[model samples]
Target: MSKPRSLDKSTKEDVSFIDRQPDQLTNQSVGQAEPEVPTGSDCAIAQQSSTQNINALPVDVLPPRLQEIINEANICLGFPKDYLAGAMLTAMAAVIGNTHTAEIMPGWKEYAILFTALVGSPGTNKSHPLSFAMQPLIDFDAEQAAIFNEAMKRYEAAMELPPKDRAAKGYDTNPIEPKRVRFTMQDVTPEAVHRILSENRRGLVLVSDELAGWFKNFNRYNNGSESEFWMSVFNHKAAMSDRKSSQSGVFIRNPFLCVIGTIQPKVLTELAAGNRNANGFMERILYVFPSVQSKVRWNRERKSPSFDIAAAWREILSRLIGIVPAVDSCGEIIPEDVPFSPEALDRLFSWQNEVTDRCNAEGSDTLTSIASKLEIYAVRFSLLLALADRACGDEKKLIDADIVERAIRLTEYFRVTAAKVQGIVSEDALTELQLAVLSELPGTFTTAEGVAIAAKCGMSERSFKRFIKDRKGVLFVHSAHGNYTKL
Candidate 1:
């Protein structure tokens, strides 16, 4: 018999995300100057440069304290600030989910846990920043594990006693199962994850250094049940774990799983071709693909991050982890509700209407669905930013317009990045012959030229036309007279 393969194993070379990516982002410095935002009828020019603005990190978009953390990771250590931002924010949101949840608008409550994907090639320092950011959660889990070990020891010792002696032991004879204090899990099955969430009703995070296995083996153990569970978690819907073989099946009233991970460009392309994701999986995720952040000037005198930074992250989390959950009649702990201010409510409506307008104008179901999910993410982000602005302390504050605007900026950044990711994946999906035609064609070409070029590649002009017709959105949407322009 053949040896079984490790389907979920990550790259053994320790390269973060991928082996390499050649399409480096524009090398812009942090202090690079930007043109002024026009306020009047000259806005058409502004629209054209919107992608550029979003691609560039508005360094000040973060609260001053959080920005300090970003600077240490990115500017000082040469990590991609975008990657650091997503990972750290998601971790912060996970801690918030343990007790506090934000209700952006009335009847629109959302957990702080967010599903963020840091998209970069190998050696982009994706995991370095994430490792630092997730330390608090790791420590929290360790503490809980130690506590559980001791509890189990006492329980085991009590069992060694005689029946009458065990009866006299009282509570020590029966140990309560350890609370699910582990907030982060790497590769795990659906049932295992369900069990974890059942214990830790607050939430748990799925962290993968290499996302190939997670995406590829999504439903390996349970048909489509695993995928369905993830979808439910993303929407904060009710979830249950029903297993035929196990009597310890768990049912959770609230299931929260925040996913943070990195993947190479090649893996992303493979999944894209599989088209295995539907019902807005790709749309639901926030992708961060900042270009080429490996260019750092090292000085022997430059100091690495010190204990203060670590202490700061720990201190913030220390307060957040102490969140006391409110319990219901059944003694189930309920998450506290975080809400937006009145002005924030007014602005949310305006933003929602604007997004709706844009989605309708796009005239594409895929794009529309992405916009719809982004709307929820925008609210989630506002909650995160609002928390960060207050130093992530226990004292909660209602999200305001300013916080929403900042989150919208980050959301817009993801929008631009997603388009780039899609562009690369779609172009990669093209056949060798199609890619050859594209390479041979000029930036702008006529239909006759396109057809002639297609014929050169062993394709009939009619077949070429049929193939290129639907590809307008993916490849090059034409102008008139078959005048196609490569984006």
Candidate 2:
């Protein structure tokens, strides 16, 4: 097939051609020539050009203070440099004043993967960056500070309350005022989540630790009721209820709530098989897998060292709160000659395809439901790098393939782990595994007998049930008797 047409360089910067058909363009050398500098006779044009470049900088080359924040956050989370950098830039750009009209501000409502998973082994300081490095952004002003305080109080109250009380109340005994809270699986409840989303319209970062624990308990507590609750919170429409008034009313819309969850790969298998909530939830998250295999030891002494720059960076980010990027009305496509390479494009598409395939195979429609979410995250990450580039003083609002590649790589690591947990056996192995188990059973067996047969086949009762359901009308047959038979 011919190569896709090069993005139209002549089009204004505000256009987006990402969804258009790829037309074959004439093969030209990569990297278009920079536009000619305007002269004094074109004073108006020169002024505009000068303004665009005034604060522009390459995202890769950040200021010392910003770089310090990046390094600190990375260290706290033990995240790969690229992953932490991308997330920080995205968050920064969302808060910073955007110079490009084509870029969308980073917000929880626009992306499906509002929750991000930060996976790493212990000592990675998973909670440090969020609690400390980004503390400034999270605790920017009185409003934010108050919100944080309230959240802690509510969490404390929930912990102190009896489980019976919590279940009966349909709300936390300690109601966390939305602004002061940071949510995680530890404190995540349908009611708490609903309150947070409804009240915090601007957005907030939710950091969860040992996510496996949350998923493990999700089903046991309520007979899989909490699992459904999570599903609703993750994708449910946000609504406001004013029941106190004589004429109660409410409005429904998307609420801005971003989540960051951490988990280990070893825990994934158990979480996935036993907990219905954990099985497919990863697809709803933007996965940012930290490097668990790194041999480079962290500096123990620096673990708790206070960085002076952290305070300064917080102040800078605070000033940019509520500033959103202007959307491009011109419908300009990101130029093809920009830095993203063919290899990078392939990686992104592959990751998307892999996630899509796994979700399809499992018959889980939520996978398809959140495709726009993954795209939004990838685009937002690129925009963050673009904004950082501008902050470092680059004139171009363009995002190259490298940014896309990095985001995809991080997303891929997360997505693959999630897919594995779904226990979706490859088609090649499915028949063999099914036949092997069936062949061991008597020609005719009751549903309870089939369960016994599964035990003999070394399949857990849970896995056996799921396997039967997954292969219905395909490899195995299900009957009204609740027993499964081989075709």
Candidate 3:
């Protein structure tokens, strides 16, 4: 309205778990800054800044080696460093798999599992970084495929023998087929996923180049069971999948599946389709949506780093994969619990209280759902970070307060990104005229002011009233009598 009045300059409150104050960090030295310990006043300042200000990933909070790899990739290889960091974090979680989990208490455990997406437009270099981060798993899958192929050849020969001759030759007449040991899956069905988790027992990562297909094909085979299966896997819950062709179904206890992929910003709304936004499916995902997306210019003078970064990453993952998980007498893999230290437990509890308070204070379901999920993510990030540090040779016996503080910062980053994504999805759903009118409204507005603004944007008074009425809890939240707050 009135040419959108050059857009409103009034600030809206940002719903975030922690305030960003780089100067207040515990270790502010030049090399690498440690996590900032928030004070009471710092928590009050959480809503001070716009979430758009936090586009860069808090790389310093990561393990030193990981920070190095991300930096080298950014400077030398022209990859988006934050994209690499996000994908790398998920890949690391996949590598750890069901081997270990972070336990805040005896009954509260968090697995190193995540569902992450790198959000940008095409040609933003989203896919390459994902491939680099997951290359180690890809190689492992290739090795497993080779082993499976050789075993299949032998099994086919064994099947050719007569029942008695095959038994005499130390091969069962009905030889068991070789199940492929896999670390990554691209085209997978729910039953296939359950079967793989059953055979591997360590879990796997689902690598998708474009998440649009992943969401659009949720009901490709069945009515809508795939979406529920995915949600169950996200929580590492026990699940069973029955195929009509088989008399017995595949049953997996404690199924673990990590997902990492890239999605265009425009395609984000599709992710919220079919009640996903309201049903907590979207809340379970951590999105890495940078404020700016530009292709890195080609630097002719750039040179690859002398050391092999991929090799370093591969070695770290190899060490994690080598950690043999304990199993029960029934042959189920048992995850070792890495409990938090007393100080860490206290710190995490305090932060959880802060999140709960924020959730209680918010009127928007989207924001509250995201805040609740971030509480869970904070614990998972702590486990992933603590274990990554251990993998980087900074061994720790337990999750410490510093690690928890680091996880808080990581969670805050994701919180801001999630808010940014919500904004994108909501904005995409608005019409051009509606968006123009919305831009003209300030952080707070009255019905008369909104009517005046919409009038200038060529919207009828009746339409403006109906638009505001329909968008309650989405574009606008009722603040008071005749007053609304733009979300």
Best by TM-score: 3
**Residues 1-487, candidate 3, lDDT per residue (tens digit)?**
0110111111101223433322121211112223334333233332223323434566777877887777777767777777888999999898788989887767878898899999987777788889999999899989989999999998988988887799888787889988898879897766666778888788888898988878787877577777888888887888887878556798888888998889998888999888787788988999987655655556678778768999988988887877889999977889988878888888788877867775565445676788788888889998998888888887676888778777876787787677677767778888999999998988878999999999999999999988887665446655567887776
Q: How far is candidate 3 from the true structure (C-alpha RMSD, Å)?
A: 8.2
Screening candidate 3 with a backbone cut-off below 3 angstroms (N, C-alpha, C), the clashing residue pairs are: none
For residue 98, give model 3's deviation from the true position in Å: 1.1
- For model 2, residues 450-483, the per-residue Cα lDDT tens digits are 7888888787788767766664433343333555
Best by lDDT: 3
Model 1 over residues 350-395: C-alpha lDDT tens digits?
A: 7677667655643445446666777788788887777666554324
Candidate 3 total steric clashes: 0
The worst-scoring run of ten residues by lDDT in candidate 2 lies at 20-29
Q: Which ranges in model 2 have alpha carbons more than 4 Å from their true place? A: 1-109, 141-189, 212-252, 270-280, 291-309, 312-316, 319-376, 387-487
Better of 1 and 2 by lDDT: 1
Q: What would you estimate as the lDDT of candidate 3?
A: 0.75
In candidate 1, position 327 carries an lDDT of 77
- What is the TM-score of each predicted model, taking all chains together? 0.81, 0.48, 0.84
lDDT of each: 0.65, 0.44, 0.75
lDDT of 2: 0.44
**Total clashes for model 1:** 1
